[model samples]
Target chain A: MLAHAIFFYIFSLIAIVSAIMVTVSKNTVHSVFFLILDFISISCLFIMIGAEFLGMIMLIIYVGAVAVLFLFVVMMLNVAQQKNQWFSARESSKHIPVGLIISTIIFFELIIVIGGWKYKPDLVSSMSLNIDSSISNTHAIGYVLYTDYIHIFQLSGMILLVAMIGAIVLTFRQRSGVKRQSYFSQISRERSDGVELIDVPSNKGVKSDD
Target chain B: MEYLSIIFSETYKILFLLVPVLVSVAMIVWLDRRIWAFVQKRQGPNVVGPFGLLQSLADALKYMFKEVIIPSSSNKVIFILAPIVTMTLALISWAVIPFSATQVLADINVGILYLFAVSSLGVYGIIMGGWASNSKYPFLGAIRSAAQMVSYEVSIGVIIINVLLCVGSLNLNDIVMAQESLWFVIPLFPMFVIFFISALAETNRPPFDLPEAEAELVAGYQTEYSGMMYAMFWLGEYANILLMCAMGSVLFLGGWLSPIDLFPFNVIPGAIWLILKILLLFILFALVKAIVPRYRYDQLMRLGWKIFLPLSLTWVVLTASFLFYFNLLPIN
Candidate 1:
């Protein structure tokens, strides 16, 4: 338990610091790197807490796919060299105080909620599907996911399918004047299409058609 | 005191596992070169040690002594961190790999998923390295890699789902144990082939190595990296290749289990069997690299999104339905 606590603290500290760095880093590329660090550290905490599946998923989804996309856009846009100034720009300076106030209120509200929250004495017992100690975390998740939460599971799959289609529809384009290989046309060509045998052409050579 | 002891033991286990892995990484590099050389009818690195066994060690020493170069316009911190990230992620994924029934570093429940996740995250190293280089070619390489990896991951995910459906467990050992009677490759040969090909693409091996296509991209993401930093990328690449081979063996080749349950075959230990399977897969990997031509960018994308996506998706459906019909699905 003590070791777990120590690891938890260490990971959480790294997560928090990196989370800050993600926002404050001057270089956009550096910010993305910091964001990745933030994700990794947080995932470490999750794994430490025995939610290994979720931790790994978070790493795969956020750090792997999403962050790479972010890095792609950042690099593609060529914004890494752009200097970031939080309050120096005159046009952006006016909203700073208001943003600060709103953020502080939200932070305080989160703190209050966390401080006031408490687990009920019977909460563990009242759960619909308790985590089975005998089975591994993946098995437990599979059991619940396929049985009790089947509808939600299927629904999430549908959502992902919709998202994939939408992305393709949005970005897919066909342009004119660009050559593309047509396997059908290429394969369908016959010798008669290009080759012609003429009896009189033996000595006179082939006549050019313009 | 108990916590201290546990920490000590864990550290000891990590050291025990890591040293062998590090050594194997070196050996795998040398072997890969030799294999590639043999395929091309050339004698590979024969001067270092017997059969050039010490070539990788010599290369490592040279890299260590070389000067570390950082581009003036590059983001120094990230430029350095990228290779470290790549190397660390490559090594860390081994934590959940079960060598045998009882031998494992960390036998977490979500072992396969953890592997999937870590391997997926391997893209960031390339992207960061390329972006931090602040050059056109490297940036282009990074973007291509990002798209390539992401596209391939979709099919890989579905393929894994097909396996998970049959085995009904994400734990690596459980998956291996489920194959006691019949290995998955015999039944799911198409998926095995697709998975192997996708693993090749995922690791940026030859044929699918568009990210570092020398004729065009000039070493791609490692364009600006030098010395130890460059060496780190090479190490990470080989480690990832090994990981993929291990994954292929575990998922399809019945892992550490002997080919048959008969007298002579079952005499060998499970760990040795696993190692043999990994080596076999590695040889296949090298053979493919030597034989196949590099794919064009558009064709690569088409293969990943069009061919593999539909094929793997259909396989998942077919596997699920077949398992259901035959009552072969493992009931958890």
Candidate 2:
């Protein structure tokens, strides 16, 4: 329990710090990186709570793909001018008042939430998995997904398919000058026929500009 | 007294395990330098200690004492947090790795899965570092690394499933024990090679180290890092290398098991054998890095996805069939 608490505190600290860094950093790339940090910390928190699958998915999908894509976009974007004056009077011109008001409201909200909170850690349900059972979490998850969550799973798949098709439609550009390979043609072509027999006549360059 | 004992036990374990890891990281730095020098036919860090063993320590101390130059133009918060994230994730992954029979921080049921999950988080640190640096080269490097990691990780995961099919357990101990009769290297030779290669790519070691290609990008995403932050990145890299090597040994070389296991030799400590096997694997890694030329970015991607992925997928099916034919599948 103590170990769990320690990990929770650490992850929360990291998440909060990274979140602030995302907005506070002068460099756009840095902000994107901070966003990656924030995502990772949250994922760690998920792992601490025994959502290992969710944590793994978060690491693989969000940190491995989305955050990276954002980093690339931010990196590629032009922000050469914002190099200096990062912490100067100019930053306050845009963010100071907004930051102050937001912080005040958040502080009040936190007070209200914390004041009314009743906290209790959930006990490990003995009935959840029998000790004599050899079936793993993956088996249980598979069973539940197939039976109870089948409809929702199908819906999600359909949504993904739609998105994939939409992406293909949007990016289907036909441009000239680029040579495209045909798998069918390549496979079907006979080596002899595919190889062109070229024999050019020699000494035909005497009649130049004249 | 009970609470004190618990605290003491935890502290003792942490100190004992962590000190070696720290030392190992230092030695890995020295090893990298020496290997680089040996390959190029020049001495590396011969000035400090015997064969430059103390050089890494000296360098680390220097980094520790040096000023952490926060780029005036950089994002202070993210820049600071990036290395910490990388190091923490790298260190945490080691918690589940069993060295021998007795040496392990956490003997979790899903040890292999946990390692995979935790190690996958490493790329985030690189991405964050690059993004936080607010530089073009680092950002480009980070993006490239992210893509490379994802592409290779698919094949790596697929290959792991092949091993799991044979071992019939996600537990590291079981995986190691399964190899007692014969190393997984014998039956799964192709998978072993693929796993090793993929691990190298995952760690961003040479040949696959497109992120830090000096000719193109000036130190890649780590361009802005200096002193201790830089050391932390290097240390984490080596630690990860060791971790992968340790895992590879356990998975393929039969962990700590000896070849001749008749009677008396069976009583010999498995931990020593495990370490020896891991060190051998690490040495192989070093040798390969020394010998191989860096692959082009396009070629790296092509090899990982078009070649390795399909190969691993095919092998998984083959392994499953073989297991079924032999009736060796774990009924559980």
Candidate 3:
């Protein structure tokens, strides 16, 4: 129990510190890195709660893809020297009140939530409600999602498909005065006359007067 | 009390081998350089030790003595933690690996899951390292690595499921022991080859190492890392290679089981045989790196999705049919 609590505290400290740093860091790149660290420590907290699949997904998607994309955009934006200072100062000031209010609400909510719930780790473990160790966590999640939550899963897939099609349609463009290769052209390429080896004199290739 | 002491004593005894094996994994850099040198008709690293066995040690000392540098624009917190995450996850995967019948650190039933989990976490370190570097090349490398890893990981998982079907257990020891009758390589040769190649691609070894292609990305994700931190990445990479090769041995080869059991002279211990097989695989990996040219990124992705994935999926079905026809599987 003590061991679990100690690790929980450590992970929470990492999560909070990095979360704070994400806002406090002057550089956009540094703020993104702090955000990545914050997500990772949150994943650690998920693992502590025995949600390994969710934790792995958090690490893989949030830190791996989304954060990398954020870094890419930040690096490629080509922030001008004078713009950087102005940008940093304006960005930090813009969100101060909003962030403070939201954080305060979340902090109080945590306290209220903990106070309202009766703590019973043993009962939760025995009931197999919070902890399900019969099989790999992925298996249980898959079963539930495919069976009980099938409609929701299918709806989400449909939503994603619509979004993907909409994105392609929005981006589609036709350029003038350019010939595009046909897919059939690639498949129907003939080798006999299309390619040939010819012997040529090396000196005739190029000659320099000097 | 006596039983607990016995377990502790056995664990300590195994540590003697595990510690050295882990350390020697760092020596792979020396081996990589020397092997490539020989391939190119040059003598390599004859200075540090007899035949330069201690070159890696000397390099480690050099990295240790050098000053650590942090860029003023870099993310201080993540920049410091990145290499530690990389090295720790790289080293921890060895715990569940079975070197021999009695030489495992943790022979848990979920050993395969533990391995996949650890290796999957490896991408986090790479992503964080590049993100924290606050440089162009590293950022691009990190994005490329993220996409590459996520894409290949799905195929690797499916391929591993094929192996699990054959062995019917996730424990590394059990998987190896099941091969005692005949090597899984004999029956699942295609899977063995595909898995080996995919392992190379997953580790981002040469040819598939687009993330760290020097001519392009300028050291890739580790562009900002220097001194001991850079050395840590080197050690972590070599350790990952060792782990992957060790995994290949246990999954396909007879692992610790000697190939020639009919003969009376079984001189080598199972762990030694395991080590020998992994060395051979490692050499093969290096050889491929030396000979093969790097594939274009699009070509690499096309091969993974269009070629390896379909072939592996076919193999799974083929194996399933064979097993079903032979009454080898529990249908219920």
Between 2 and 3, whose lDDT is larger?
A: 2
lDDT of 2 by residue, B1-332 (tens): 77689889988997888888878878877887788789889887899888788998899889999987878877777788888988887888878777676677887667887788767778878877887787889888988888898788888889889999898777888888888788999999999999999999999998899999889998998899998898888888888888888888888999878867878767778877777787888877888888899988988998998899999999999999999999998656
Assess candidate 2 and give its lDDT: 0.81
Off by more than 4 A, model 3: A12-191, A195-210, B1-18, B260-267, B313-327, B330-332
**Residue B257 shift from truth in candidate 2, angstroms:** 2.3
Q: Over the full model, what C-alpha lDDT does candidate 1 score relative to the true structure?
A: 0.89
In Å, residue A102's CA in model 1 sits off its true spot by: 7.5
Report lDDT per candidate.
0.89, 0.81, 0.79
Show the lowest summed lDDT stretch of 10 residues, model 2 chain A.
A118-127
CAPRI-style grade of the A/B interface in model 2: acceptable
Best by DockQ: 1
Give the TM-scores of the predictions, in the order they appear: 0.91, 0.76, 0.74
Give lDDT tens digits, candidate 3, residues B1-332.
77679769878866775688667775777888888788888898879989998988888999999989988998788888889988888888888878678878777665776677677667767777887787888878877776677667666767877887787666789788888888988888888888888888878898789988899999999998899999888788888888889888988887888888866526677888888899899999888888899978987887788888999888889888888899896222
User: Comparing 1 and 3 by lDDT, which wins?
Assistant: 1
For model 1, the chain A TM-score is 0.78
Model 2: lDDT of residue A121: 23
lDDT of 2 at B40: 86
